[model samples]
Target: MSEAVRPGAPRAVPYLRQPAFWIVIVLLVVGAVRIAQIAALFFGSFPLATLTAIVMFGLFAVPFWLLLAELDFLEREPAGLRVLAFAWGGLVATSVSIPGSTALDNLIAKLGSPDLAAEWGAALAGPTVEEIAKTLGVVAIVLIARTQVNSVLDGIVYGALVGLGFQIVENVVFAIGAVQQAGLGDRVQPVITTFLVRGFLAGIWSHTLFGALAGAGIGYLVVRRERSRRRRVAVAGLALFGAWASHSLWNSPILRDSFGDSVPAVLAILLLKGLPPLLLVLYLVRRAHDREAAYYVGILATVRDPGLITESELRALGSGSRRGAARRHAAASAGREAKLAVRRLQRAQAGLAVELSRGSDGAGACADRVRRHRATLAALGYPEAVEGARSWRHTASTVGTAALALAVLWVALSALGTA
Candidate 1:
């Protein structure tokens, strides 16, 4: 009659052990190979410029991952899916879009006029081509595993990864082409100017944003499976169309005339174009996070054992900063090891809460996991606040990040100056 000896939830299956994981890995490898071949061909034409394009854009790609991760913090998607999303964008989507868009442009030239194809083909073809190509990544993911996306936020994150992948690779191609247009002595200048323009100016509204919007549409279709199939399809279509229109607007030459060339003026126009969609996504994410947190927090009342999760622990999970402060609190009171132990405790509790919230039979198992972590924490003692100076490691990390950002800005400016 004792629940103390009851089993815990099954341990997470290793990614390598899953068949789907291996499939994703294989796909990623194939994509990487294709991209490498293309990059190699480009590099052979002009090595330094191509390499610089990859390196600077490599730096540019980091914030995309970091921002999307932050957006999807509470309910993280599987790492394999995330990798697949990025690969689809970087490798498959980009590879497909370039040739596909070019072919369409050529067709336009034949049908209309050469001038028309050169001037307006991208405005027509790019949105239709690139948005769909990037979106196919999300579709592939959903087809492979339908249950991975539970909310609009998940789709947005996945889409963002795919878009980011496409954007980085695309930027490198642009860089290479820009440098090629310049004189041999003046290549790096163009590459740096490209970095400043693409990475700093236009990047905020690039493929990732388009992908996020389209992915949210896909999320609606999958997550709302109970709805009439027609209704779901409509939502998905609308999301895709929004992405296409956004891309179309960006590509439209009208913005150049209406928005003007002033740096501040251009940024203000971009915000006007970009902010509403972003605000909607953020609002949805907030609602979803709240709904999930409420479910988990509500279940704690039924948990029956205070040792498994305290009220403070339940409250802490609501905000990342609170969670961090709790870890620091644990470290200050107990030892450094206790910090990790406390984190494990929080995670185990969250696991139990998830099982309960999902209506799964694994709640008993999850409870066992929570109890084990509780015992570990009990052995270490409870965390109490202790006043102390900030850790040197934390301070150093902050300083290092600031220095790196400054370095990047200086390089961009210097490169532009030399140009």
Candidate 2:
């Protein structure tokens, strides 16, 4: 997970020497203590409901963790850093936002009429406090590990993990509130209903997406050093504003009054509010990924050693689909072992590219790892690269997955009722 420093990239500071590191550690400890106290109260009040919410949201994080981990496959963020980002989100941001958002909402009520605050308080206050808290999680990462925050993709990865942490913890808190509001005597039904609404319906484009948008801004601010400092700060501000605006729109009451609360209406509202930011973040991610892929692939091309990385394999490594296709092709032509070997070879080649980018000799440890994997592939009689094809089986699987997802959505909607 070591990254190459670009010409004029900021020098790394030891974490122990950085005052910001100590500040972050203190905040995390305070947050953990606050969360533990809240958990104790929840357990005392509704043990079964609290446990159910915890378990459900804990499981909800698995796919998100896996998906975000792969976002920067070429140069994966260190596992420790990833955990740190998530912890900041779940602990520091969530704990701070609970009280901060409430206080801001109260302030809104004082400044404006009660009607204004009642209708617009959440839209105004929640995003202001929560987005700032969550965005700071990304800033904290940058302060702690400047070297790891080299690319915009790194920012997106860290931001999304922070958002995921916030989203999960916030959802758990909401689930518990649902139980209390329902007056159902510690029943799990309210928790399940909350999960269906928050986790199933609005999960994708919620906090994680917002965090990523803000993270992109921070990434741009830090990595685009060639730009004027004023311009970089402006871009970062715009990005944070974008994140806040998106979150505010989601919390606003504009659609609720106009569209009613039927299942279809709810779905439409979610899409209307969520789609723009989702599409924007997707475009940013695609652009960032392509740029990074080109840079890494260019580094590998200089070696000109088929034993290390053939031209075709080099091409495949730059693409997500082609990389998967290479492995699938290996499985079809050779055995499963060949498929695994191809994957290992691709990873090893990526490592070598990283090593080369850092001005290391081609004969270093990364190169040795590449040679070992290449030899393993040759032993399986599949040393050369393979191309991907669109097979009938692939098409069928794609269609089947879509069908299953739609079915689940329908069931969830029905279970929750139309209004």
Candidate 3:
């Protein structure tokens, strides 16, 4: 059966009809009410600290959100679905895991000893409970909108969103805990410290990365129809295990005192714990993105329309870097309008490919939209086909970004008592 949609063909059942949708909604509402009660308690006592944590972690989520948004640029997930994923992580997963992890930790103490639980409780209980809860968010997405998750990249994106949601909410909770632990009178200092340590220093390798790893497995399982069911399930389980193991190691007591409190020592510890998983997730993202890009570009390759997409444009469209280079080449040759035109042209072309893939008759409309942008580019004297090259500007931009990041790290570390 063709995957394409034709007139009178049945559409996906509305989300309202899906039992998973109601299940998710109920969980979200329950979580939200519980979290709100917690927030209220914090606000009644340490309003300033609570506000500070909320604002800081809210800001922290922006960059992660932007980067993840780019992960599936070819076929962006729906905005509503993305919000649902994040809410599941923040509200549902965190709410469930809070009590769940605590109970499991106590059980570990009973099974072993208090000392052993103190040392390994977080490493074991937290990841075991939290990963399962967060992975369920991706499963929920699949249950409600399976068509939206047609690619592995889609699963990664949703999983990352879920992780991001959990990370932000959990950081806020920790920040407030810091304030309470410090016995500070509604001060923001403790909140700032928590932000530096958790939000800045450890944020990169935390929940979001783990969620992506597990999400990759979920994506692979859902999309790889060619693979044997047992193989796909095994791969997905391995992925989830990888996520849990990484999270466990990160939270473990193994390196809590291994390195001294110096800035270099702390950074080294973080790198040791975080770098491997970071590299693995990056490789998966690149691999998934390339495959998705090739599928879409291949669809366009058959169009044989220079006005819509030329050979050079096809080459540029297949790569994130090359796509940016094409826009830059247009901007430098003409003006900012040329860059905008090129972006619109690229979006229209992508839309056309998507419509074609769906077996929809809207290909003509998509092609018309592409032609408008093509004309705009021509009028602006922007040749949208020039390949991008590494230039002095790129080098300067890279150096500048690194320097700025280093400066910020230094300030954060100094504030965090690592100096």
lDDT scores for all predictions? 0.74, 0.86, 0.87
For each candidate in turn, the TM-score is 0.77, 0.94, 0.95
Return the clash pairs for model 3, or none: none
Winning candidate number (TM-score): 3
For 78-197, candidate 2 gives per-residue lDDT tens digits of 787799899999999999999999999888888887888899998999999999999999999989888777788888889999999999999999999999999978999999899988
lDDT of 3 by residue, 150-246 (tens): 7878888999999999999999999999899998589998888888899888999999999999999998998888789999999999999999999
- Better lDDT candidate (1, 2): 2
Per-residue lDDT value at 137 in model 3: 96
- Choose 1 or 2, whichever is better by TM-score: 2
Rank by lDDT, highest first. 3, 2, 1
Q: Per-residue lDDT for 222 in model 3?
A: 86
Which regions of candidate 3 are displaced past 4 Å? Answer: 1-13
* Per-model root-mean-square deviation over C-alphas: 6.5, 2.8, 2.7
